[model samples]
Target: MATEKLDVEKSSVELSSSVSDINLYTLHEERAGRLVVDPEEAKIEFGEAIASKLKLSHDGTKVLWPQPTDSPNDPQNWSEGRKTLHLLIITLAAIVPDFDSGIGIASLFQLAAQYNTTTEEINNLTSNWSIFLLGPGGMIAVMLMRRYGRLPVLFWSQIFALGFLIGCTFAPDLNTFAAMRCLTAVFGTAPQVSGLYIVTDLYPFHRQARMVNLWTMGFIVSPFLSPFLFGFLVARENWRWSYGIGSMYGAVVCLLIAFFMEETKYDRGVKDVPEPQSGLRYRIETLVGITGFRMAKYRASWKEAVMSQLNIVWRPHILGILIFEGVLFGFGIGMNVTNAVFLGSPPPLGFDWTPYAIAGGYGTPIVATVMGELIGRYLNDWIMNKSIKRNNGVFEAENRLWACYLAVVLDVAGLVLLGASIQKHLSPAGLIFGWGIAQSGVMICTVAVYAYCNNCFPRYAGEVSALINMARTMGGFAVAYYQVPWAEKNGALQTFGCEAAIVAGLFFLIVPLLQVKGRSLRAKFSL
Candidate 1:
């Protein structure tokens, strides 16, 4: 009787334990299914039931997309002041390439005179070549960043780019100047791609769009701002002074980065990683890349790093976004190039505007870009928050595309207005209004695209950024080859109208398809 009673108790305990195990398993399964609809699409659960299980943002109102580790070195946990300083440094660095490129535009006439060549030839040999290299340079920069470290790659590249800018300032001949320009672009493009990477490192998904807009404002304003300021400079002094000023700007950026920026590249996915040691030796090693090499074994192998970027290039959804962005961005570049020629050319063929007048015109895009930034800063996050609420705290990357609708409308209207104004010889105000409006639209589109792609593949943030940079630069490069000729062959009205139509049609067709089917496509062709 005693033996039987003991056996019965043992059996009862085993059954209860088994039930507990089953209950725990079921709970886990339920959480997994509810939390993520598609992992590749970054479908995250944000509110209520899972709040205690995951890391929440500081305010406790939303779940952090990347759950932070306990390590203090994690950039996500950095103090607000540190993040802001880093952002300012990166933004300034990103502005360097485009700013230098614009200096060439402002000095076009003077360069032609100095080289005994036509303005068209000077543009072709110098600015166009430099723009083409920016894409490829960004790819190389990201590869190095992945294999080495972000801080070292950025710092060294800026130093080399600064050297080349000095070369541009002192070049004695057109060939020498063109060569220097190309080299400057190759090294100068590091920050343009890396800025996005650093932003991803420093901020959560909810804040990335706003931070990206802030960083983007630097480059977006740069192209026009440089020309606006330097156009008059060139008219007073010579083109060399413009490049000299650029070199000074580059120097200032380099100093700020060297002193202030921290290495934001942290492997949060790794388990039991040791806290980074701090001291003079470690700091020196980190800055010069010795630490990166030592820690490289923890990161991807060199070959894997390079091949991963290529893989991202071929993914169907990413490829689609690249194509769409390239086409839309190409038109914006075309406008910038053509506007310079139109406003600066002699009376019969152009506006016959003085350098001062042309410089003032560039202000239109600057103001427009500012307006766009203000709207996009909060626009994407608001759209995303609403979607999350509607879907019961499940965040979908596709919701980010909603902002593009307003962007397309603005873009189309502005392009049409600019074209008609130019074709009909309308007043300067008409030109300015059209230019400002079109720029505002482009600015909004930039923010939406960057935010959406980053959300889709958070792990591959650097790769996504590099590819986007390629699409943007390569598109602009192609347009530069043909923008003026196309406008000359066809009337500006017809030319810009067709450009506007292409943007509208492509955006509507592609964006809607992505909105409805994007989740599935992401799952089917994941990185």
Candidate 2:
């Protein structure tokens, strides 16, 4: 989809501008290529050396010589089963680190009690996980999406995450456990890119918001079941079982991927191209990923593709979304996690698992999230369609962003209530009920904002998504360190309430028609 749109904008001059990976730039007509070229021509004169090479679909879908004329290059044109496989692969790759975040916190007290260590030491594990999942991990993943196939990268990451989980299970010391968590964050976070990336790959540009929301649901699902499992295990078998369960779950997901998932990284409906050129070291690694330069018809060196990938990393829109989601979602969500700890602990604020963990997280918020996702997956499509029609069908990307209004409303309201609820330290039911609103509101934000960011780029969805994760992960990291201390110092109520109001206020200001001038107030998120 990206290549097709780009080719449309590519004047003859841009092709020369892209001349670096010249080898991959040219493709030979072969099996896929030949059949592609001759829709009506029964066995054209190539009689002897039935030339071999993949070709881009004609009508400019970014392939090489001898390709189909009408190929759409949109992943949606693939089989229904293929789409499902793509989503599954992403869920497998993306869900682990996220599940570990909120779920793992409950196990901290148990872990420290067993080792006779302090909670502060255990907190490092969260830091390591956060940094890898959203920071350096995201930056690294951006390269992989362009260099390696999306499916391969996603598949490998899940398998690696399984390995890390296993390592965590067998850890002899806190350091060892911490190390495994970090490693998993690096490898396992690959699929998170897929969540936003696939919307562009598989759906029509106008149809993207709902799909992005659906992927967020996949992410939300893992956490729904994760905390319960964590609390149950840590309370019964000790904290190690928490790691064991995650590892086992990851292993099962990896197997599912190996068996059912298909490689979606290929440019659907198009022949591959010679990638834009780049440096020597980058090319060498690209060769390995491009399969020893085996996919020669496309003429892309591992090096050129990497450069193309890097180009995406630096885009302002991608950076904006990553920063926005990573920080805002991370800030709000991370605060929710830490505050839950503070609010639930014994004291005038005496709280327990039944209300906090089970009722709030597992009950009200879970149900609300499910409802929100259903809206995202199904009803949201209808909303987008209506917006498009009202716009006279020009279909700017901003048309799809209105769903953010709901999220903004909930986020502000929840933050305000949460801030006040803390000082009140109400009964468990009262506290959790208010907290549930915050959790659900954040999920709403995650679903809508994520869709908005990913859809911002019809092309380079993977890169855009990667940037978003980086920002979100970094935000979570900052929150992991600062939110609680800030809340504690600032009259927990005063500071949190004020921050919540600010976020809500900002969301309202940005929630209008999606752009100011040509600049796009939401940046490139203009429908």
Candidate 3:
């Protein structure tokens, strides 16, 4: 990364050789061939350190880097082998909070007997642990992801989370125990934000659903399976074993990521058609002004970087959509998650500490994400093709709207049925079955929402997905906390009912919003 001098007027100045990977789309298709790059333009744009590879270019002003923008070796474009490995690592990392988060259900009755605490507090603690982690951890993970790269953030956060888990394993007091759970929440969720980006970076837009479906296994399956996984551990031993086991899994994944997952922060050499800038506008703009305006290559001031994200967060359009996406993702998760705890703790629904109910809560849905994703993939493809045919070989952004509509309807209906089943106070089978259907929304929305977001925002695609993930995480946190007092005041059965009502409202709103806002590829191409 060496700097070079560009002369204008009488003065010569050095500019940063570094360039962000904003043009993720242009790389040679990694599915079959070689990644080629042009260095002459590399020299013109970024000296050696910034441009890593060289391919020649003729134009003095306009330049190209022969190296594929989304090169396979680029950490973002990790191979299928490595992508699967990464998800495995994310799965193990997830097992920590996920297992410990709800595994406590098995011990709640025992704990209430021994520690003299109420079932309500123990249940609330578990639900809140899962919910609050989504928001708070995601908030912090956003900054961590921007600064450290995805793999690094996940590795370090898991290591810290494991440490917190170890502390929870032996906490002498409930306060200390709850504090440790919160700590685990803070670190355990960092991996989630990075994991989705890992999928996007490596896979093409069309193939992304399959990769995302695979990823949903970890996110959707892990939580559902965690309770059951913890149950068997609880049966063999004590609740401490549950905490200790997931923590051990965490430590192992942390080590594996540190050893295998390469740092994805390398230069991809693809960039956007920069907003019209005076020659001076090309100067590096960090948080504040353009970097080269007064100085050589400029780094964003820390304050500026922080404020940049804040600015994005505050933009009216960004904020509105963020809220919409958050509600879409968070609603099903909050409803099913909070309701699952009712499987135990409540009498008539009681167990002799059997692992069956808890296991059922988390285990059935492993296939839900896989199944939903598999189905959504076909439906999404079918809809895209149908729209193109209807448009006479042209596609509209709104072409993707059908996927969103179908997913939301699936989710809302699932929640209302699950709520009704829970309110009916049926057998373990009815509740679990209803919940299983509700959980399918995770997979449906995962593909549909993501596909929609990617279609809508082509400019900063990775960050846009990351922002959506972050928003969803924050929404989960808010709704989870909201459910706590809500459960206390109204009870769990009613809380699910409330979620149903809210989602019913959201489903109606998103359809019209998309109708007005979305334009198909032809609509855009026509312009």
| Candidate number of the best TM-score | 1
Q: Write the per-residue lDDT of candidate 3 for residues 341-424, one digit (tens) a residue.
A: 455535433322245556556665665566776777688778765765565434445555576666666666666666555556
Cα lDDT tens digits, model 2, 113-167, are 7667865566656543545455566556656666555555666667777787788
Residues 1-527 of candidate 1: C-alpha lDDT, one tens digit per residue: 99999999998787566544432212322232122322322323322223344556667666565666667888989899999999999999999988988889889889999999988898789988898899999999999899777999999999999999999999999999999999999999999889888997888766888999998888877888788889889989978999999999999998988888888988776555455678888887888899888888888888988998898788766777788888887778767766888888765447888888888888888899999999998887789778877876677677878888998898889999988777778887888899889899988988888878877777777888899888988888887777667767776788789889999888977899988888887777665
Better of 2 and 3 by TM-score: 2
- lDDT-better candidate, 1 vs 3: 1
Ranking by TM-score: 1, 2, 3
* lDDT winner: 1
- Give me the overall lDDT of model 2: 0.56
Cα lDDT of candidate 1 equals 0.82
Model 2's number of clashes is: 23
Q: Show where candidate 2 strays beyond 4 Å.
A: 1-75, 125-132, 268-293, 296-322, 349-362, 508-514, 518-527
Q: TM-scores of the models, in the given order?
A: 0.91, 0.75, 0.72
